[model samples]
Target: MHYFSQSFNYDHSWARVVIGMWHKYPNPHCSHVVTVDVVDRTVDPRTGIIRTERILGCKQRAPIWIVKLFGGSEDAFVREISFVDPSTQTTTISSVNLSLSQFATCNEMIRYSPAPGGRTAFHQTAEIETRMNMWRSAADKLENWLALRFEQNAQLGKVGFTDVLRQLWEDAKDKPAHVSA
Candidate 1:
């Protein structure tokens, strides 16, 4: 098993950053995410919290050895669940890869919260583990590869989301205010 964690701050408010999360896909930097579908969603009227479940489709090339060993193509799928609480100004998202569950599992967690100076703090962690009863050498190699890929994708995600937030808020900031007749 391999573990990874990272934390940073975004130059945006918590609310704005959480709202930008939904628009992160289809970004150039994170092009591996091909499709996103909302499977379930609910809002708590009393607490003003929203929970959402989604499936994300991803396509990325795998190493030749991995392809031969795993017998899978470039397509993969992930199940993601998220919770947003306005009262606490926090958002949390968790995801797991579904395509390669029999061989291994990659679980990821991300959180966005209010930070000092009106910024949003971002934190992420992941665990990559190969199923038991596999050859130890092969399992270690697989875990290492997955960890490297996850780190790369995490960096890309940060860059992509930064672009999305800037575009979203900057464009809105530039627009003129509407006047009621």
Candidate 2:
């Protein structure tokens, strides 16, 4: 198993940052994230909290060795679930790779919260583990590759979301008072 974690601040308010999260895709920085579909969603009226489940489709070329060894393709899918609590000014997202799950799994969690100076704090962590009992060497290689890919994607996600937020709020003279998750 391999672990990764990172934290940073976005130059946007918590609400605006959270709202921009929904529009981070189709970005040049993270072109691998090609499609996003909301599979489920719910809103708690009493608490004013929102929960959403989505499936993300990604297309990226894998290493030739990995493709040959694992018989994998360029297409992959991820299942993501997110919760937004307006009352607390917090948003949390968790995702797991749906493809190649029998061999390995990549679990990622991200959080956005209010920070000082009206910025939003972004924190992310991930765990990559191989489930295969045998072929220890192959499993290790797979885990390492997945970890590297995840780190790259994470960086791109940060840049992509930052751009989205800037485009959505920075240029606008009037920002929306409230944005639903």
Q: Candidate 2: which pairs clash?
A: none
Please give, for residues 1-181, the per-residue lDDT of candidate 2 as tens digits. Answer: 9999999999888888887888888999999999999999999989999999999999999999998888879999999999999999989999999999989999999999999998999999999999957498898899999999999998888888888888788655375645434
- Residues 38-123, model 1: lDDT tens digits: 99999988898899999999999999999988889999999999999988888999999998789899999999999999899999
Candidate 1 residue pairs in backbone clash: none
Clashes of 2: 0
How accurate locally is residue 104 in candidate 2, as Cα lDDT from 0 to 100?
A: 92
